[model samples]
Target: MHIGVPRESDPGQRLVAATPQTVEKLVALGYDVVVETGAGADASIPDDGYVAAGATIGDTDAVWGCDVVVKVDAPTVSEVARMHADATIVARMSPDDDPALVEAMRAAGVIALNLNSVPRISRAQALDVLSTMSNVSGYRGIIEAAEAYAGMFGGQVTAAGSTPPARVFVIGAGVAGLAALGAAGSLGATVRAYDVRSDVAEQIESMGATYVRVDAAAQESADGYASELSDEQEAATQRVYAAESAAADVVVTTALIRGKAPITITAEMVAAMRPGSVIVDLAASGGGNCELTVPGEKIVTENGVTIIGYTDLPGRMPKHTSQLYGTNIVNLMKLLTPGKDGQVVLDLDDVVQRGITVTRAGELLWPPPPVQVSVAPPAPASAPAPAEPAPAVEQKARKGTGVLVAGALTALLVVAAVAFSTASFASHLTVFALAVVVGFYVVTGVTHSLHTPLMAQTNAISGIILVGSLLQIGSTDTVVTVLAVVAATFASINIFGGFSVASRMLAMFRKEA
Candidate 1:
């Protein structure tokens, strides 16, 4: 089997798909490895390095003509035309946004394995290119924003005066947002983050940044990505952005709705910001989070706000990016490589293969099936039917027993109510505390799998509790009113907190595009 490592032809794509270390591994796996001349030059890996690792340095045609070809970006129409028929190409093919690339690969009869389509399962984490790149992009965005701003990130006290720390506001709490938050906070900037899914508050706070709360329901899809906001929710978010941006020295927007453009930072919000404020839009590649952001250009508004829209932040650190990307490629290759023979095997039955296999065997399988199909075995023979129920007399007897039990319960409740009316406040409080303890235990008994639904249900129950507390707010007793207000406040927290937890868990299931 022949595996080719082609030079990345995309503009500003310095990261290569494989490093010499990865090339050596592939060579040892019984494959003839060939790397294009100067393929890894930008990433600091010379042709001599590839040669040292037992890989032959070849020309563009030689590299693309191999049985397996890998590169950093999607193949261009011209590049696809050079690939051998039925050759498998592994790269970050943005199928959703680049339908033409999918068609091009199909027409060229190449099996395109898109790294971006790798599932978010535990086994696939080592092969997640999107995550590896996003981590770099997130951290780099902070650096870009800080550099573009005229002010300093950390506060300093000099003989002249004290310079205040920069205030950073991050929109979206996904992988990139969290990275930006960590980086900004480490630089001594006062950071705050906002997300449509409220569940990321703890994560945000964990990074030493405050979490901004918005008056909106969580908008997380089942796959764990943030869904499009409703009209009212968008309005609320815009208001929050306007206020936050006005007070922010730097704002990093990483909010991305898969397959759609992200516009979390509007031009109006930018105009509201003070002079010298910086806005870094990490979603610039997919349109951008800021309305005024050009895909690959930086611009300063008349108000003196700088919007940095550089798309390939990961490429800025090509060495590390290529190292991480190379490991991801090697990990994915392990799944496709069946044995020491190094032949590429297409196992559609495997979840990872099914996910990344966009085109297979000259057929365009773009947007692979959501779920794999499985055949169920035939059932065994069934048992005989049971006998019929008892006669009407038995039914009447059962109804009589139920009425007796109900009447007995009603009598007991009446006696208990009379006793409770005369009981002291401490005794009533004891009963309430005991009920809370019982409820806590009941909740703890539920399995982890049901925790999200349980939390949601408890949130609704807490809202009801808030309503009851509200009714008591106008009570004649001062003590009763004060306690009611406290109860209502705590209930409100529980309701919001419950939604936050559920939203966070849902977000975990979102696969990278």
Candidate 2:
């Protein structure tokens, strides 16, 4: 098999399909590697590096003629038209719900393996192109903000006085938002983040960023992605959003609702922002989070604020991004490839194959799962079958059994108390024995009378009293008295603690009933 890495044709896509390292891996796997001239240049891999990795460096025409054409973006129609009928084109084709691109891949007779369509399974982590790019896109979002904001992130001490640190407000506590927060916070900026998932607030706080939350109807999908908010909820969040956005020197918005364009950032909200503030819209790829954002362009607000809508943040850091994404691509391909003995094989029965294989055997083989329909519940059963009541005689017997056990435990405790009172450490031991007996009685009483708390308080009071008695006992026997006091305190605490535990158990029984 032959694999080709082509130069990206997408306007802002700076990523290369395969780096030299990945080319080497493909070569080891029994595939001839061809890379278009300057294919990995944007990603910091020179043409010489491909040659050193045993890959042939060729022009675009030669590269496109291979058995497989790998790319960072979907190939243009013209490019597809040029491809060999049976060739496979591997790339990221998101919102694959689009029929035109789906039909084109079929007509071209080139198998399209969309990297973005991979699932978030544990075994697929290395093959998750979406997660790979997202990790980089997340990091770059903050670096872009730092560049756009004129002021330094960290505080400075000048001849005049000290200046406070810059403030960063990040919306959406997803991978991108958290990365932005981390970058800003590392530079000593006061970072605050908000998300529709209130459950993630603890994570945000753990990362040293303050979590900002507003009261609104929260909706989360089964996959844990934020669901689109209703109009009322959106309106309710605006004022709080505006206040936080207005105060921050930098704001990074990463909220995205899967297939939809990001929720619009209203003009009123933009107006509230201070002049010179910087906003990096990670959601710009899908419309934008800001009202005035132009995808892949930076727009200056009427108030002189900079709203950056650059969509391909991960592309800007292609070296590491390609390394991460290529590993994902290789892992995915390996899963699809067949092998024998010490070799790899594709299991068609695997959920991964069914989920990501968009088309097979010249047909659209992939479709989203059917939506679950709610069925009207059956009416309550008329005259529900009567449950057999527990026998009254058995209930009485169990009560008697409990009482018998309590009495045996009490008798054992009494014997121990007698032994304790006559022991050499009598004075201190007597108090502890009395306290233990009282504690057991209170716990076994079947009800939490005033004696429960009273027993606990008395246990503590006995400890203090023991110490006072020891002090009066003086030096000749002071050490002995102190030892007795320590023993008494330990025994009393254990006794009272057991009673408290019993009270808790009884509460559970009541609640269950």
Q: Report the number of the highest-TM-score candidate.
A: 1
Total backbone clashes of candidate 1, pairs 3 or more residues apart or in separate chains = 0
TM-score of 2: 0.70
Q: Show pairs that collide, candidate 1.
A: none
lDDT of each: 0.84, 0.75
What value of lDDT does candidate 1 attain over all alpha carbons?
A: 0.84
Per-residue lDDT tens digits of candidate 2, residues 2-65? 7888889875677887887887777777778889988887788899999999899888888888
Where does candidate 1 have its weakest 10-residue lDDT segment? 371-380
Clashing pairs in 2: 339-344
Best by lDDT: 1
Q: Can you give the TM-score per candidate against the true fold?
A: 0.71, 0.70
